[model samples]
Target chain A: MALTDFSAEEQIAAVVAGETSSVELVAAHLARVEHDEWNSFLAVDRERALARAKEIDGLATRPPLAGVPIAIKDALSTRDLVTTAGSKMLEGFRPIYTATCVARLEAAGAVIIGKTNMDEFAMGSSTENSAYGPTLNPWDLTRVPGGSSGGSASSVAARQVPWSLGSDTGGSIRQPAALCGIVGMKPTYGAISRYGLIAFASSLDQVGPFARTVRDAALLLSHMVGRDPMDATSLEWTEPIRVPSATRLDGVRVGVIEELMSDGIEPGVRAACQSTIDMVEALGGTVVPIALPHAGYGLATYYLIAPAEASANLARFDGIRYGHRTADADVLLEHYERTRAEGFGPEVKRRIMLGTFALSSGYYDAYYGQAQRVRTLIMRDFAEAFAQVDVVASPTSPSTAFRLGERTADPLSMYLSDICTIPISLAGLPSLSIPCGLSEGLPVGLQLAGPAFSENRLLEVAHALELAIGFDDAPQGVGV
Target chain B: MIDDAITRHVARLARLGLTEDEVVRMQHELSAILEYVDQVQGLELADIVPTTHAIPLSNVLREDVPTPSVSAELALREGPNVTADGFTVPRMG
Candidate 1:
């Protein structure tokens, strides 16, 4: 059987049953990643990975995820691998320590197969902004995998890894998962530690998982969720969530956000959402249409708040520290110019400029402060909607994955692709994207969002829907 | 509310040296986006508290423990220019 054919749980079972060793599993995955042409990885540290696998294989006591292979998003720091953040700025910069999330995964006995590609500094929705190259959707090589977590999402969707980690600033995890046709979850903002994640917009940045199934996503999430001393903003939720069994969706009330559906949804995308809604209702769950008044301006609020925070968080990369430095500079001003000019990509530079402009002295009140007030309104809207329903359902993106360079020329159009998923992210709620159906042979996702810290509940609903609407396991090339 | 003057000032704060043409381009683009965002001012939010983060967060801090780092020699290895004890660079003034 193909290694990717097994779910994350089954892989662990294989390790536990003495059918294989951790090194063998790691070797198999590395081989698959090499032969696979998705360009999902930026750096694959085979020697270090095989060495770690041998060490884990010697363990007498197996952890829950022993020997399972997973990919790390390039944005996080890993001592064994170069933490590039998909930009030339940190090209050779090796972090002294591992990210808390990566450390936690390592402790749980999972193997770090490689570092995946992303938009430079996690700035774009598609991976086209990577200084290296774009990550193509495994389903359709001509098309983009959803991004800046595109590499992580596409790897799992292509059956290259059982599960992988991705960071979400504004729908980075869920958006790509939808585009790649896999299960992805962005936990409540502070639920996972952000210690080693290179800050894009610190306030909104979060680490999440992309998996082949809801249960697998939850299993990885449970391992990664906890407060860490390194990240001051991390939260401590004392209650341990039990993974819901197959029958947990009874009497659940799911609210469909009215504004998201009417805005820019394509015809096939709408049908898939309605099909999921019908499945929810058939299973004795109630589905209702609800209005989020502030959601109409969600994109606007995100641009302001995220960039303002980014402008502050990114100031530390000004060449005085340990990142890319320029040559032939006799003076400080010349050094700053050469370093940044060579380091950052067009998208990152654009955002830094826009954020700097927004937070400048005279414009601060009108742009940044006004954006915050509107954020309050958006949060209130979610609060009111949750009062009437247990979860909200929608298409993860307005349309399926587009071709590479399709929207690269227009940055605004690319940013608008995140419209539907950005609101839930802004509210710091838990959301999951599961493969619902196909549109024009490309995969679309059904986005299920629940109240804060309700990851288990959200996964339970996704599990129920997965059973209702089965997904095709056929690789795109085989049938085509 | 934003114009070429504001763009120049913001660029300076960002430490970006933009030419006159780049300044004009950014001014028009930022102006268009800011005008769209101005719609947020329509809401009266006197009663609401502004939120900086989505979740209520508590700072997780470790005890101030001294940790060992790489020796200065190794730290400055990647530096283009190195001093006897540290990294050397262009003069600040």
Candidate 2:
């Protein structure tokens, strides 16, 4: 059977039923990673992964997710593997301990296949920003897979794993998932522990899951979630809720944001979104046009606040702690300068400087403070709209995947690509992106967004949508 | 509009010493970006609460457990140099 043909649940069932040992599953996945070397991982820790899988096979009773093969985003720390954040700055840096999420997944018997590539420091809209080579869209190989979490999304979409974890700040996870034609969830901020995930924009970053199916995404999330002492922002424990596949959209009020739809949206993408809404309506869900008056400011607020936080979080990579160091500097200033100059890529430095400027004492009020106030308004807009609806719906992106390097010359254009998805992240709401339908031979995503702690509801609705469309994984034979 | 002054200031704060040519290019690019952000300024958002993140949590924390870390050799493997149980680097002063 094709490696991309198995689901995470199926893999687990196979392991449990003794049809395949944990070591076998790990070896299969590792071989697949090796075979598709160009599209996914930044690094493959075959020895470490195989060793762990062998250990798991020896266990008597496996956990709920025992022996399931999984991939971690390069952004997350792993004791046995190098956590490079897809940046040269930490090219060979190994963490002392596993990140909380990775540890939890391991405890559940999930095998860590390898770390996938991403935008450097999770900073770009496309994986092209990676210090390592950009991850190709498994579906096309010529077009982008969507970004930051692009590799994770593509890996799962191509069935390299049943599911992979990704980090969403702005639309990192959702946009890539949308573009790659998979299910990606950015649960309520702090829904999962961020203890081991390298900090990008501390305030905005949330670790999420990418899967071939909505339930699979939910299952992966369940194993990795719950509060962690290391991450003050992780969600508190709650009884695991299995999102029934029978969920119907009937009587669920969904608000379709008017601001998300404008002339700029491609014709095919807009049509797909309309079809999704029609599907929702056919299922008895009410679609209302809601105004997110503050959503217009989401990109602006994110640019300011994310950078400010990034400036601070990235300050720790001073060549003396945890990451790459330079030995050629003759003085302290030279040491710091040379290390950073040689370590960080252009985009990372660009953001750090922008953030430093925004937070500088003289400009703080005009930049970061104003952005924070704007964030307040954006959150309030969601609060008001949710009073009238259980969820909000929108296209995950305005257009389908563009050719590689298409927007590299224009940063603002790249930033605008995330417009529809950023507002949900800014408000700290739980949102899901599922493959709604294809547009112009490329997949377009339908976003289902709900209020805080509404992950179960989001998943249920996503599962319902999945049933309505009967969407299946179809990465083969797609063009850029 | 963004100009050389803004680029210089931002670069200084970011600790990047960009050349004049790069500064000129960045100034033009940032000016375009600021113009895009200007669109948000037109919205009448007097009472809305600014949104920061998508998830909300009061205290998702970890236990105060200090675990043993990997050996220093492993931690510093990626570094360019290491000595005396520490990563060696150019002098800060």
Candidate 3:
């Protein structure tokens, strides 16, 4: 059997059964990374990856993820590995400690293949904001792989690696996974620890997994979730989540958000989502119309809250500490000013300015304060909706992936691309994006969301739908 | 729309120096974004409280025990300029 044919779980099983060696599996993926046609990885750690794989091959009892090759988003710090976060500010900076999630994955014998690219400081919707170039979509090279986890999604779509880790603050993981035709899950906030992740809207940011199948994502999440002493907000799992084994969706209540299906959504995307709802109903499930009245304000509110927190969180990048510094300045103030101006991209600067203005003395009550109040209303809407249904469904994006330069010209239009996913982030709910069907020859993502800490149930529902859809379509010329 | 003066002022507050062109562009863009987000101003928030976090937690304290931490050398490894035991920076005015 070919190396690329096995799922992540199967790869682990093969190594345990002595059918394949970890070295061979790692080498096959490393070769793909070296010849990466999609520009997915920013830095390849071939030597270290092979060394780890060799070590795993020598072991008698294999771990859960032994010998599986996984890609990581550069936002997560990998000890002794270059983590650029797709910005020139920290272009060659290497962290001394690996992130908790990464450390756990490594402990499980998953070989870290390389670091993937992302939007500069995870600030933009499209990967075009990266200091490095944007990642091209594997489906259509002329189109964009969504961001800020574009590289992670594209790599998985191209089958460079079975799965990759991506961070989602506001739809970064889901939108890109939707565009790339893969599975992406943003677990309930604090479900995964954020110890080694470079901050990007800390309250909303959560590391997630991207894979070709929902089961693969679930396996990754099983290792990623757990309490961490390093991250104060991390939640401890009281008991192991029981993965539902039932194949049918009998007695399952799926809530279709009435507001999300209306205006701004493409006809094809709308039709595809409706068909998924029909599929659910036909599979012994009930579909009900749910209301999220305050969801319309989610994008606007997120722009304020995320950037406001980001403005404070990102203040540490001044020239005094780590990251890029300006040499032409003699005074401390000039050093800071020039360093930040020279380091950050346009989108980052825009957010900093917007956030600073919103939090300023005179405007705090109007912008940041009001955005917080609206955030409450948005969460309450979700709480009320969850009371009526077990899971909420919507299109992961309003439309399929657009051309590479399609939304780059206008930031507002780019922000609108995340309209469907942003509301879930604001409410800190668990949401997964799965390929429903083809729309205009491109894949459409059906988003399944549930109340906080409902990851197991959410995944179960998604897995059932995934089996029904049978979306095993891979990008052309990939994994053949 | 916010004026260029406010945009420049905000940039200064953010410790980012914007060029003339960037300031002008920021003025236009920030105005557009603010106008869009102004939709929140229409809500009736008389009794609604602000939500800073979805999960309610307060003062997450840990045991008062010292643990091994990243060495100063490793921490300063990524600094642009390093001194004998610390990071070097521009002199204050």
Candidate 4:
């Protein structure tokens, strides 16, 4: 087997066992990434990666991911790489510091292959919002890989890299992972420090990992979590995230959230999740129907809330700052308007306008305020559901990969793709999407979510189920 | 539904320069999204305490002490207009 196809753990063992060098592993992945079949990567530092790999080969003590080639989402800042969140606004912008998540990865001896493409500022459901272009799915070159973490998910799925990092703010990680047939996780809010992560919606954005295996996801995430003095919202967590070795779901309770399972879900997706649920029951786990009444309103509430925060957070992209500037404007007001108008794409402008209206006088109470209160209701719904179940399970996405441009024109249709995943974001929980099985020749994702700080338990349950399902995650019609 | 006035007003507030066509596009798109988000407008949320963030915590203050920080040169590295140690912007009217 090719070293590029090996699991992250196996790759690390190979490096440590003197069977191969870090340079070989990184070079192999770099060659694969250069194919650019899916337009997955936005930036790559070949020189640095090779040099870093050489450094790892000389290490007396091995770092956990020593010499392993991994990809990072553009949303996370890598000081050495140009970190544009797939927006023209930050086209040439290079961040002064690396994000806490990427910094942690480097410290653990991983060679960052490149920054993956994402939705502009992590705004869209598909990576189509990327100024460069959409990242096509590895399974079907014509289909979208899902976004704004589409590139991260697709890169791993296509085996360009064993694993990568992607930020989840409204299904960016999980949806793409599901659509691309991989394990994608968004840990609990504050579980990972947001120190250098470019802000989308401060309260909702959390950095996570994308991997081919549940255990690999667990391993990648273990090194990334922990409090950072650089970020105020950071939290401490149980270190070295370990999945239970016991591969049984005995005595576990799986709640299928009613709101996410129906209404817009493809029959194939529903059937795949149902079969996974049956597997849960077969493994001595009990399945229960859990109701989340407020979840139906998740999309609407998120549109108001996420954009409201985004409008505030994205205001920093004035012409004078690091990103793209307008040469046409002389006055400050004209400069601000024209620079952003020229720099940002359509989706971003729509959100900014929508958010400004929501927070404007005579509308704040009706829009942003109501959304927050409804957010509490959604949180309460999840809180109550968690009280009755160990973790909730649903299809990570409503349907499998949609052909590129299918829903791009109609923003609302694109927004509907996230219906199943948004409420979990609203509630701020540790959730993961593992490929359960194939439907209609495309892979389907079974989303498992738990209460805050339930990552260990969540990982254990997902690992057990992933073993039971044993679905192959290799992309067809694509060769590395 | 929001009209063009609100659309233009919001665009101005958000500091976005929209072409005549974009304003029309934004008007239609914003109107549709607002109508969709209108679902939350009728909910009786006045009685519920709003959640500003998912996790609840008081102050997130850290220890007050001087430490090494990013240099002015590094901070201004990506500035569109910059001097040796500071950013340069258009003069105020």
Candidate 5:
């Protein structure tokens, strides 16, 4: 079998069994990345990856991910590689320190093959906002890979790499993974340290992993999660979730969220997700009807709250600190204005303005305050739902991968793409998207979410469902 | 709908510059978004407490031990204009 054909775990096994060397694996992935057709990777660290692979080849016993090639979203800092976060503002800015999650991945023996593309500053639902241009879907070249983790999802789907890391502020990881027909997990907030991650919306952002299989995602998450002094919000390390190879859903109570299934969902997507629920029933799991009453307001609430946080978090990028600066300004204020205006894309600027307006003196109580209260209500909705169910199931997105430039003209339409995944982020729950089936020849993602720190149960349930669904649809003719 | 004055003010606060056409477009878009978000005003939130964070966290303090930090040279390496001592920005008005 081709090296790219092996699962990440199988690749590690191959290295351990002396059937394949780490150098061979890394070189194969690097070559694929170099000749990528999906525009997935932003920077390929060929030398560093080969050097690391060589070192691993010399080791008598390999680490868990000893020879596996992993692509990183440009959002995460790498000490040597440039971390652009898909924006031109920090186009060539190389970090002095690596993100804690990445540091852990390196220590686990994973080869950092390259950095993937994303929506600029992780802002948009489609990667068109990226200064580097949009990443095309491997399944359909005209369709988007989704964002702001589009490149990571597309890279994995295209088989440029077996697995990759993506950051989710508000469905950035899961939405893209769903579009790409892969598995992506957004752990509970604080599950992974965010030290070297350039802040977008501090309260909402969580680093996650994207892989072809649920088990691979679990493995990646296990290596990445731990507490850190640098990130006070980091959660204490929990025992890694072990997904049984033979997955069974007996006694698993799957909650069917009435709000998530409401109107605007495409007909095919609804059918695919409903079938997955039926499979859960056949596997002896009970499907309970649950209500997230405030879920209707999630889109609006997220728009206000996330942007409000982003407005404050992004204030640090005033051109003097780091990143792009304007050359034509003669005074400090003009310089600040020119730098930001020239650097940020329309979506980023729009959010900043909306956030500033909402948080302004007279409007804070009306916009920002109202959103926070609604957020509490949304959290309560989840708490109440989980009382009757072990996990909540929904379509990861309202529709499958949209054609590129389809929704870019209308901001509201773009925001609606995340309606299904936003509430979980607001509630700080662990959620993952796994391919259930196809919608109009495109992959449909079945989202599974649980209360905070319930990643173990969530992953187990998702694995069982993935096995039952047996979705092995790979994008055709994508790799080298 | 938000007026051009308010939109411009917000842009200033955000440190972003807008053209005349952008201001008009932003005013309309912001107004529409605000109208949608105004749905929250209809909810009976008198008994609801606002949530600043999803997971409740208190003041997280770390030990006051000195740890290695990025060197000054490395920190300023990405700056647009840097001198030996610090980053150089345009002169203040």
Candidate 6:
């Protein structure tokens, strides 16, 4: 098998065991990056990646991820790399500081080959929202890979890089990971530092890893997570996430969220989820029906809360500092207005308007405030469910990869794409999307979530279930 | 439907310069989304505390001591028209 085809853990092991040089491994992966064929990468500086790999090859002693190649979503700053966050507003904006997650990964000896594409400001559920272009699903080129982490997810799925980092505000990581047929995780809120990530909704955004296997995803996450003094919300994780040695899930309680499964789910997705439950039972894990009564309102609450936060977070894009400056502005206020008006796209504008109205003087209490209360209720529902079960199961996305331009016309239809994953983001919990099996030649993800800081337990259940399901990660012999 | 006046007002608040064509479009879009999201107002849970952050956190305060940091030139490198160690912006008339 090609070095690019090996799991990230296996690639790292090959380098550590002197089976393959870092340069060779990186070169093999770079060859698979396909020169803008997938629209997955914003920048693929082969020269820089090769030079970095050579540096790792010459090291006196090997580092943990010595010679491993990974891609980062453009939302995270990378010091010298231009991070557009998939928006033309900040087209050539290069940050001087690197995010805490990127810094930690680099310090542990990983080579960043490129920055992946994403939806503008992490707003939309499809990479079609990207100003540059949408990232195609590697599984089927006509379909979208999902967003705002589509590029990152597709890159990992295509084996351009064995693993990558992506941020999930509301299912960006998990949905794309599901659509693209790979393992993606959204760790507990504040479990990983958000210091350098371009802020969307501060409370909802989380950076996590995408990998070919759950263990590899866990390994990459373990390297990236820790408290950052820069991000006050970041917490020091006390528990060690170990690669589970046991292959069977014994006495694990998997709570199936009834609300998520009932309405608007595709039949193939439902069949795959039911099969997952049966497989869990086969592996000694019991399934319990969980009722999250308030989950029906998660979409409504999220639309208000996320956009309200986004309006505030995105207000920094005025022409004065960085980002696009309009040529027609005569004064400061015109500059701010015209710059933002011209720079932001339609979806962004709609969201800004929605958020501005919601937070406006007379409407704040009825919308944003009420949404926060509903958020509290949703969190309480999860708290009640977690009390009975160690982990909860749902479909990461309602369906597999949708065709490009399928949901773009109607904003509400596009928003519904994230129905299954949005509630988990609202409550600020750890969740993972691992491929269960194929549904009509497409991958379907079975989502597993746990309460705050229960990633180790979630991983334990996921890893064991993964082995039992024996999912074929390949999509019609597509990549590496 | 959300009125044109309200839609324009919200657009102004957002500092977004929408064209008249866009104003009409945004009015319809905003009305539909707002109508949908207005479901939150139906809940009678005023007593429930709002969650600002996912995890409960106590503020960590420290001495406001100056630390070594990035140089002004490097920090403003991405800013438009950096001159004399500061950003150049249009003057308010």
User: What's the TM-score of chain A alone for every prediction?
Assistant: 0.98, 0.97, 0.98, 0.98, 0.98, 0.98
What C-alpha lDDT do the candidate models reach, one value each?
A: 0.85, 0.81, 0.90, 0.90, 0.90, 0.89
Task: Give model 6's clash tally.
Answer: 0
Off by over 4 Å in 4: A238-240
Model 4, A150-228: lDDT tens per residue? Answer: 9999999999999999999899999999999999999999988998888999989999999988888998888888889
Tens digits of per-residue lDDT for model 6, A129-190: 99998999988999999988999999988889999999999999999999998999999999
The 10 consecutive residues of candidate 1 chain A with the worst lDDT sum are A471-480
Docking level of model 4: high
iRMSD per prediction, in order: 2.1, 2.9, 0.9, 1.1, 0.9, 1.2
Residue pairs in collision within model 3: none
Worst 10 residues of 6 chain A by lDDT: A471-480
Worst 10 residues of 4 chain B by lDDT: B84-93
- Output the number of the DockQ-best candidate: 3
> Model 5 reaches what TM-score against the true structure?
0.98
Model 1: per-residue Cα lDDT over A1-480, one tens digit each: 676678888888888899887888888788878875888999888888899889888888987788789999999999747888999988887876789999999898888989999999999999999998999898889899989999999889877788999999899999999998888999998999999999999878999999988889988998888888778888886766555467546899999988888848988888888887888878889989999999978899898888888877877776765788887788887787668767887788778888997787777887888888888889999999999999999889999999889998767789888998889888999898999999888888989999998877888888888878888745565221
The residue-by-residue lDDT of candidate 2 on A346-409, one tens digit each, is 7887788778877887877667777877888788889999999999998899888888999888
Q: How does chain A of candidate 4 score by TM-score against the true chain A?
A: 0.98
DockQ of 3: 0.85
Q: Give the DockQ ranking, best first.
A: 3, 4, 5, 6, 1, 2
